[model samples]
Target: MTVENALAGLAEQGWVAEAEADEAVSRRVGRPARRFRFRAEAGCMLGFDIGLHKVLAIVADLRGQVLGTRRTAVTPALPAEERLAAARRLGHCTLRSAGLTAQDVRGVGVGTTGVVAADGTVTRSDLLPDWTGTDLVTAFTEPFDAPVMAGNDARLAALAEHWRGAAAGTEDVLYIHVGRRISSGLLIGGKVHTGRHGAAGELGVLPSSRWDTAPGRLLAHWADPQTLFAAAGAGEAKALAALEDFADDLAQGVAAMTLTLDPELVAVGGGLSRAGRLITDPLSRRLAELCLFPVPVAASQLGDEAVALGGIRLALNAVERELFDVNG
Candidate 1:
């Protein structure tokens, strides 16, 4: 079928096309002119960042304008389905606040804070014990009736930064979130590189660590990094020493990826990113000392919203693929 025909079909089916898809493909492949069914200004896209304490839902249109947003906290101890239901309710509330309904939404994109499989399952999560291997897509799909796309929260944050925040215009970039846990997200060629098994960028637990101890035992030292940072900020000498040591170890991990991926820029996010140069400067220097090449580092501009915006991008991509795949 012709591109225009596919575009019309998608629009009729309540899916909005991406404004840049055809242009991007044309520029990359030098193909004949094609278009997707996208509104210059139409309905909004919905995005959700499902976190341990709360679910954040943000809505935006094709022009990247945020229309409405809502945040709701729920018990992480609840079952995965219960948490997902709460999340869906939050999305509905946000849409209602904007004087719209689920029908008005183009698509739903989600970034879950844990290891997310391609099919939208939470493979594992220390933050949300009830979400392990839970199929989150199924939890919301029936209720919402819109197409859904799910991805790792950290990776989505990287995607958001690349598209609209600090990493804008960069094709090769690494976005690291250093809040509750340390995880890295990769953006190669303007897209998130989720690995073959959709397990890419799960960097919180070091691969070299033994896994037989216990479920959460691998990260038993988790609190140490935060405590060390707080002490260093307070000018404690011992804390300073510990912070420097931890920074060195983080640099080693980053350098290992640097040697392999050679990303152009490294953008750090999450609550700890506010530490700013305190962490980045030392880490950058250490990485440079250990690396064969120099790489620039920056802080995320969007802060926590990076992953929420990433969900918006994922939803846009999903609409294009499911409803406007001209190649299909």
Candidate 2:
């Protein structure tokens, strides 16, 4: 088709609009090309992170430019219905803040703490009360009138890291989410490696694994991992000891994964990753000791937005495939 025909087709599809030319061009092009541009009001997408203690909603454009975000605190003790309602509220609020509405949303992506199946069902959720077996796709679809995709938060964080953060340009990665829980997300040959049962990264499930108990024990004395790191940064003996123990246990899990996959890079993410040198310095040293070869480790630069940004990436993928005929 000619350029005119292409422009006509795009105009008919509401993707572009013709505007009067502000200036005339030289005669390299016939009659100076008519000015046409993408529509000003292009559709956007929503990315939501429903965590154990908070719900974060992000609104972004097709190009993944985040316009606005809203976060609301939530407790696992709340009823499932209440938690869902809170998520919805935050989602709408984020869209409103972005000057968009649910009708303008082309797709929705959700990241949650659980084992998410390919169909967006929560196979299991130990962090949230009564969240297991929830169909997240349907939950968002009805309210947003958009296609929905859901995945494990840790796994989605890995996706974000690969797309625009710490793991960018790498094909294989081992993403360890160290916070109140221990989990991982693997990327093999540039694709997410969700195990057969969608629980590939539940490292804490290993029988008698120190990952299962170490974080809890440390948090028992400190309010959170950050506080513990603060104490350690101040050279408090107990806090330093706890961090050393935690690093050793974390390295054991990392080594197990390294032996199996031999990933190109290891990215440490999640809330605890904010500790920066406090955690990375020790964890890197431990990984070097455990692995036969040195493995590069870095803290997630995306911070708390990693999972939500990953959700945005997922939403963009779905919308592009369905509406733009492009592979994600």
Candidate whose TM-score is highest: 2
Highest-lDDT candidate: 2
Q: Judge candidate 1 at residue 17 and give its lDDT.
A: 56
Q: Please report, in order, the local distance difference test score of every candidate based on alpha carbons.
A: 0.76, 0.85
Question: What lDDT is reached at residue 215 by model 2?
Answer: 75
Candidate 2: residue 267 lDDT (0-100): 95
Collision pairs in model 1: none
Cand. 1 TM to true fold: 0.79
lDDT of 1 at 36: 57
lDDT (10s digit) by residue, model 1, range 37-127: 4463567788999887778999887556788889987766777777788888998998898888887777888998778888998887777
| Model 1 bad stretches (over 4 Å) | 1-41, 207-243, 322-325
